[model samples]
Each structure stands twice: as structure tokens, then as C-alpha cells.
Target: MQYLNGKFQIGYSIRKNDEEFVYNNGFLYSYSDDPEGINEWHNYKGKKVSSLVDPYEIFFYEPADVVPGKVKITASPFWTVTKRGDIHFMMNNVEGSDKAKNVHSYKKASDSEFTHTTEFPGGELRSVGNDLYLISLENDRPVIRKAEGGTNDWTVM
Candidate 1:
């Protein structure tokens, strides 16, 4: 039951009665101390699998490290630049899907990472004096929304 940084080290044995198997990179690993010294490897669905040469070589990944409910961006993002020269965009996810199509901002043009600004409807994003505003069409009419401070709260104007 020894782990380092959420990864189970090799040769560590779990309790025999522990029905929960270990998983790493979507592969399940099971420990055994039988006379033949063969470890069982299975998929997440409990089906037997042999994709790995040795199960002990695999490190069990912690479930908390796995990102839940992550979805892919389905369309192009509306990009805009702030007055302070920062970049921002409103990304679009799949239509009619429960996933987020949120707005994100970058501190600089060369930055590889983006900060999540707020969950916004499909719209054209504009930066007004370093503030984010969305111009979206709602009910066949154009609506303007402004972000409140640095939070996800927005106000329709």
C-alpha cells in the first residue's frame, strides 16, 4: 500500500480481500503471490487483458489525478485582445451538449496556458479596458453581457 505522489511503487502488495484493482493510464493491474508468480492484468471493465509484459511494471494511478467530465472543444473560438495586450477567447464545445463552452484569457500572447474566465453562451468576445464582454444573440435579439471583476459572474446590460 505504499505510493509516491499518487503512483503505487512496484512490488507493493495490497490486501488479498481488497477487490478494488489498480489502474494506470486506463489499464488495470492486479497483484498476486501464487506459486506460478503470475499477475493478472485487466481492463477497467474487468475483462482480462495482456497488453503489458508485466503487471508489476505498471504504476497504479490515483483516481483523483484523473480529470473528470473533461470534454473537447468542438468549434473555433472567438478571439479578442484586451487593452493591456492580453488575449482572450470564448471557446465553443459541442452544441446541445452539457459540456462547457467557456471563455478563457491569456496574460500574454506567447503564453501556452490559458486562465478560465467564465462559462459564457455562444458569443463574440470583446475586451473593453481589460474587461471581457460578450455579445450574443438571444431569442433573435442581440444581448450584451459583461464579466464582473475577475470572477465568472456576469451581468446582462
Candidate 2:
């Protein structure tokens, strides 16, 4: 792995090292060895994506080994930043193709400190005014719930 100022350089092989899959506030840089794949770097803001840094962070994601119970949380693909500027994401208790995913909101006190604001079993996140909502499919019926307050504050609906 060759890094120029903490970034991987050309000729770096991901198979040989554990390079940071992502970094910066909301910048996601990925490199895949698939012959048909391309190495790309991009940033996403709101519903828009750009090659340059955007004005906001749509989502902030960090992956880790699954820890049972307390430490077992994940930041999966369906994520977004709320209008109030809090980072929101989803996770599952386990890993694999068919595991149940849950929505979770967390604020980063630092790079290593992620404190949960709220969590629920659902599929998506959307905000109306300043309130947060989660949607899920329960028994084949659509269920929606709202967060009661700021991050870490909620009243189950």
C-alpha cells in the first residue's frame, strides 16, 4: 500500500492490505479489483452526488466486526443526514446476505466515539419538519414511526 499524505497511490492492491475504504467527512473512495470494475471517488449530498466536496453530508458510514448485544451495531447502505445536521444510518445484528437490517441514528463525538441517538427495526428514513421517521414492513403491512426528539431521544410510536 502506497499513500501520498494518507491516501492510497496508484498500483496499490487492496487484496494485499486493509486500506481505509472511506475517510474524510463524507467522501467515499473505493477500489475494486474486478476486471470490469473501476476505481472511483465521489461525495454525496442530499439526493445529489458530485466529484467535488458537496455542501452537506448525506451519510457517514463506518464498518466493523459484529459485537454481540451492546457493541453490535452497523451502518449499512440506507443512510442519510437529517436537516438538523445529525448523522443517521442503519445496521443489523449480524452480517450476510439475508440478515435483518435496522435503522439507527448516531452522533460522532470523535472518530472512535459513536453514540446512538435512536434505533428501530425498519427499512428507510425520511424527515418532515425536524422530526425523524422510520418505515418498515411488518406482517406485510407498512409501518411508520417517528422519533420524539433529537438524537438519542425518542418515544416509540
Candidate 3:
């Protein structure tokens, strides 16, 4: 650590084999020897293998916006994808409150926005197989409930 001008600066040193190191504008960067993996693939006999299709052709990507404009996701969402391709999400909107509400919602794979369901007390959601479960606090004790299908309606388990 060093005090330069009026600010304190920290420094670090790292050593790794087959890594190129660079320091510029108070920033450090390290890169592998084969950064782009031009010779990556290998056969069973440790010989370079050739494929009919290139890596980019084998794995194509096209980015798209998934979130809806009207929806505001304020908290960490507990989400799961069902066997039928429906997406279920449970989130608590209350920030730093003891009486937070856990709101449940879902959206079909073809739908653009999610449909809100009845809200329940604060809890964490867990999905097992095609079943959904919730673990909440009741009188400071752990209480468990299973969701009825993909809706918020729950049955105490």
C-alpha cells in the first residue's frame, strides 16, 4: 500500500505459468497463452482433431431482452421452470421489514409478461421436480407449505 498525492493505493503481484501479464493505467490484466483457443480440440491420441463445422457454427447465439417494460423487479426473485415450460417466480418486495410479503407469479413460455397471484407471508421458495414448496417463519418457527400447481395457493405440509 502506498499513499500517493492524497489517496491510498494498494498493489498486488501474481505469478502463473503460460500467462501474459500487463499493467496499464493503474490496472493489471493477465491472459492465457491460447486466449482464443485456435488449437483447442484434441483426439484420444492427443492429436489435433478437425470437425466439419466450426465452433461458432456449432454454437450460435442471439441476444434478446427478456424482461417486460411494465414489470419492476425490485428484489431477488426465487424462480423455477416447470416441466411444462411455465416459469414461476416468488419475490418479496418489502425492503428491511419484518412483515414482508412473498408475492407469487407465473408466466407461460409463450407469454411476454407474468401474471400476479395471491401474496403470502415472507418465505423462501424451493421447487422439487414438478412440485413447488415454501419455507416460512411462523411465530419464529419454520413452517412449510407446498404450492397447488403453479399458483400461490399452498397446502401446509
Candidate 4:
């Protein structure tokens, strides 16, 4: 099955032992799946490949909208496609927490560069150059820096 969300498109196939799902964001294609379900899922379809499978039945949510920069699909918690379809934000839940989370939040910066953010407490995530940065308030003061490379790698002037 194939689904288009702005600049990103998703293709998926379910098989008995090896299922594959791929997401295309203009510049690159990313994929995931389980190998065990490939054959079983493939066999049912036989030679018919063009037939539309009911995505609504398999997914948790219905597609609310599809446009150049956005697509909303019904999933466990709902999902939004952004950046001409380069980004996909899926609603999720944190383990042992009552609040819902947004997983799979990715944005394409270019044909070769993409970024994603995971929500945390009292902070915002962003990308600067090739690094991921976080800005948060510490002791009522704004603390800004690269999140992964090293401490003090970034400073507020």
C-alpha cells in the first residue's frame, strides 16, 4: 500500500514472514519491518498488486487530510505529515505516564539532512548546523547548547 503525506510518502507491504514499510522524504527513503511476516502476507494477495488494501482498517486512525505540506492519518493516537511530506509526527504515549506523546517527529532540512525531536519537560528541540540543540530554562535563566556533542559546546552571547 502507498500513502502520500505532503513531501513524504509511505509504502508498506505485509507478508507472512517479512513485512516491509518504507517512508520517502524527497531525498531519502527509510524503511522498517519484520522479516517473519513477509511470506504469509504476500501469499494472500497472490498476483494482484494494484488492489488497494484497506489502510483504514489496519491503521488506528482515518486520514483526516492530505495536502502539499500536511497529511493527517488516524493511527493509535493520530499522525501529521509535514514539510511537503518530509516529516511525520505520530501521537504516542510514554510508558507509565498518563500524558500522550508525539513520536516519529522528523523534519527534512535538505535532501541529505533530516531532524527529529522528542518531547521532554520544559524544553524545546531544534537543529543548528549538523547538531541537535536544546533550549531550556535553568534557574530562571535561558540555557542554550548542543544536546549531544559536548557540554559548553554552545554558549549564549
Candidate 2 ranges beyond 4 A from true positions: 1-61, 67-76, 92-105, 108-113, 117-119, 152-157
- Per-residue lDDT over 69-110 for candidate 2, one digit per residue giving the tens place of the 0 to 100 score: 222233433444444434444443433243433435454322
Ranking by lDDT: 3, 1, 2, 4
lDDT (tens digit, per residue) of candidate 4 on 1-157: 2233212233322221112111211111222122322222211112222223543222222112112223222233222233233333333322212233333334443333234333433234444334445566779998765532211134443
Q: What is the model-wide C-alpha lDDT for candidate 4?
A: 0.31
Counting clashing residue pairs in each candidate, in order, gives 0, 1, 0, 23
Supply the TM-score for candidate 3: 0.44
> After superposition, which runs of candidate 3 have C-alpha atoms over 4 Å from their true positions?
1-75, 95-100, 108-113
lDDT of 4 at 118: 35
By TM-score, how accurate is candidate 2?
Answer: 0.43
Cα displacement (angstroms), candidate 2, residue 52, comes to 7.0
| Residues 1-157, model 3: lDDT tens digits | 2222222222222222222212211111111123343434432122333541333212111111122222222444455555544456555542221332445566554555456644566477666656678888888889999864456667888
Best by lDDT: 3
Error of 3 at 141 (Å): 1.3
lDDT (Cα, 0-100) at 125 in candidate 3:
69
Query: Weakest 10 consecutive residues, lDDT, candidate 1?
Result: 9-18
Candidate number with the higher lDDT (1 or 4): 1
Instruction: Give the Cα lDDT of each candidate.
Output: 0.42, 0.38, 0.42, 0.31
Candidates by TM-score, descending order:
3, 2, 1, 4
